[model samples]
Target: MAARRHTTTRRPVLAAAAAFLLPPNPVAAAERLAFDDLYSGWSVMGASFSPRLLALVGQEAALRGYMAPPLKAEADFFVLAREPMALCPFCSSDADWPVDIVVVYLRRQAQPTDPGTRIEVVGRVETGSWTDPDSGFVSQIRLRDARFRPL
Candidate 1:
């Protein structure tokens, strides 16, 4: 008896269906950002936003950093710093702010992770200086509607 090759259109259909069933890849979907990548240079005025960072402005991006302790146990936002900071920068003067820090505004209020804990945050990037109306916090950069997970 002669053997015949087996093929079916159902394979493609099933694969398409499976793709929809699978959860989206967060890492793949977001542009990875870094503290060192945030700036191009600094003048007497302040740090300049790097071309890479500016390009990500108004777009969804991700960055890994240490979470600074938030003012409240649970809040809608927190600060992410290159290195773990013990004190709340928000509670102090602007002079105390870390060089590599950016505000992360969460999508919802949740318990803040321990200070210095490394985590990856994903959100829409915003550039230029902006102040939080509710908290009276000023930030050069921010990640809006962000969510984070431990790295």
Candidate 2:
């Protein structure tokens, strides 16, 4: 008669166990925000940004929206809107820019999706009025170093 013993590797087991000890970051990952959550209220003049939205500035966040038509088929930036729009949000004028729209500046040029295609974007949230130097596009809210995928 004979007896056999089995052995298991410790490295993998130790690595898996170590992961549990690490603290989780509340904002380590992008937080999902809704179009409706962008503003606090509306008026003939304009809407105000909600405290929650303003508080997210400089933090990574995600937004789901439809891509507005871009100035070029492949461009470094585009506008995202709550609903599909026939024209770029900044095409008309700054005053006409919708509160529900957010300018998305990509890490690199990207082929914008069709106007009707829904997409989700992740990037650093930026708030405050700023104008693009090249296109002369004006925006109050923006997502910088962003990436998007079809929804």
Candidate 3:
């Protein structure tokens, strides 16, 4: 018996099929939890991360959401929102996103996704308060060194 090589046609077909069958990956995927499941409580002052979220800190999390407009024309960080925000959370001093938003810090600047495009963000969850020194925006929960793409 002789060894044989695979054809390129089969390789492309297999690659395409693999892309569809697999869930969207961001950095790496861990146990998936919905945005609704991120917080156990929501309030004006702040929200508490659900035990599920708190327990997953420093672990990868996959959160599905839309990309909100960044505070600056360019930002090191972006916000993933459950819904398209009509107002700017940073520009509009009174505006604020839901407590569950996952503040995504991309390894590098990524082309902003469509506001309507649903994206999956994955990164190590950081649970606590932090302010963006450049923007002064406050966040209770964030996903550091995150990456995302349309779902």
Candidate 4:
């Protein structure tokens, strides 16, 4: 009887095969858009959407920012700001919103969270200025049918 010996050369091939069989990463499919990339020109009137933003309209996109408090306890929308907002803009009259803030409308109701928490949001990019008929919140950029996770 002869003892069997294992060959190390097959390990690489097996590893590659296993990797190929795995599902594709969801993050790779989403186009990452930074807060800086949201605007191109700033004027006394208002900021203009960048070319990158224009091209990404109606496409899947991802943004990372702090999750501001929701407008109401039952509302499905919240504000995503460049920095952690100390006060809820919707609730406080004196809370000045950022010029480049993104209004995020969740696909489903999200649990109330602390305003200081950092989060990564994924959704379809919506460009152009539009006012939410319900909340009357005006925004230049928005993420519709969005979902988020803590960063």
Candidate 5:
């Protein structure tokens, strides 16, 4: 009897399965930003965004920080701060936001987490002064269409 010959054909099947299971590549990776890099100069009058920050406007970016309290229980927007804020500036007048704070406008409404929890936010960087029509909250810089994940 001739020795049995077996040819395995599983390699291609395995490769195809891997390709299907893998996560799709993002259109573009977000540029990581540090709070210290948000500004070139800061004063009582106002702050000037760093050249790097300015150049990144309209581009996808990521910032790691604490998420300040939201205006409502379920909201689409929140504030990202280097530290936990004493007050939710967007919802209060007694406390003011830090110059380097970045407003985060999420793509969908979400239940906010504790103020102390650190988070990483991803979105398109938007510069210049603007006020939210609904809340009348003024912001110098913001992350539009943003989303966040706990750190």
Candidate 6:
């Protein structure tokens, strides 16, 4: 009688190593932040940014939310909402966005992100009252220099 020994090759391990060397998707780097943590206070006048949001200024923050209708379909900025927005921005001039909204300023004019879509936004958390020169929309909490993609 004879006994046989089997050996495994290193090719599979090498292939796995190569796959790991590939660059990671940019969207994967966006950190998730909840709406509850976006602000500490809510009011008609203005809302205060939470401590977590304040600390993220000038840093990339990822917010998972729905897209509120833009003031204009072709506007540069759009509001990220916690829920599907029922109000139309164009229909009502007095209609205000939520206090926790993260104003998204896209890098370029692109198709609006899906209103029903859950998206992650990566941008600098800008806190202050700033008026949009193009749309004249006022916002206390903004996510400037931002980019977004559907989740």
Q: How many clashes (backbone N, Cα, C below 3 Å) per candidate?
A: 0, 0, 0, 0, 0, 0
Q: Give the C-alpha miss distance for residue 107 in model 5, angstroms.
A: 0.9
lDDT of each: 0.79, 0.77, 0.73, 0.79, 0.77, 0.71
Q: In lDDT terms, how accurate is model 3?
A: 0.73
**Candidate 6 residue lDDT tens string, 1-102:** 122111113433543554477544344444446788777887888577777778888777777788887879785689888998876658755556555666
Q: For residues 31-138, what per-residue lDDT tens digits would candidate 1 score against the true structure? A: 677788899898878788998899898999888898887855667878889888865557876568786689999998878887757898889999887888877878
Q: Per-residue lDDT of 53-98 in model 2, one digit per residue for the tens? A: 8989998888889888785567788988998876445677645655
Query: Which stretches of model 2 miss by more than 4 angstroms?
Result: 1-28, 87-97
- Listed per candidate, the RMSD to the true structure in angstroms reads 11.3, 13.7, 10.7, 12.1, 13.7, 12.6
Q: In candidate 6, which residue pairs clash? A: none
Query: Which run of 10 residues does model 2 get worst, by summed lDDT?
Result: 1-10
Error of 1 at 120 (Å): 0.4
TM-score of candidate 3 to 2 decimals: 0.74
Model 6 segments more than 4 A misplaced = 1-24, 42-46, 88-94
lDDT of 4: 0.79
Evaluate model 2: give its lDDT: 0.77
Candidate 4: regions farther than 4 A off: 1-25, 87-95
Q: Once model 5 is optimally superposed onto the true structure by TM-score, how far is the C-alpha of residue 119 displaced, in angstroms?
A: 0.2
Better of 4 and 5 by TM-score: 4
Whole-model lDDT, candidate 1? 0.79
TM-score of 4: 0.76
Error of 3 at 150 (Å): 0.5
Question: In candidate 4, what are the lDDT values of residues 5-82, reduced to their tens digit?
Answer: 233345446545644775533444566778988998999987889888899999988888998777778658888999
Candidate 1 weakest lDDT stretch, 10 residues: 1-10
Q: Which ranges of candidate 3 are over 4 A from the true structure?
A: 1-28, 43-46, 88-94
Clashing pairs in 5: none
Q: Per-residue error at 149 for model 2, in Å?
A: 0.5
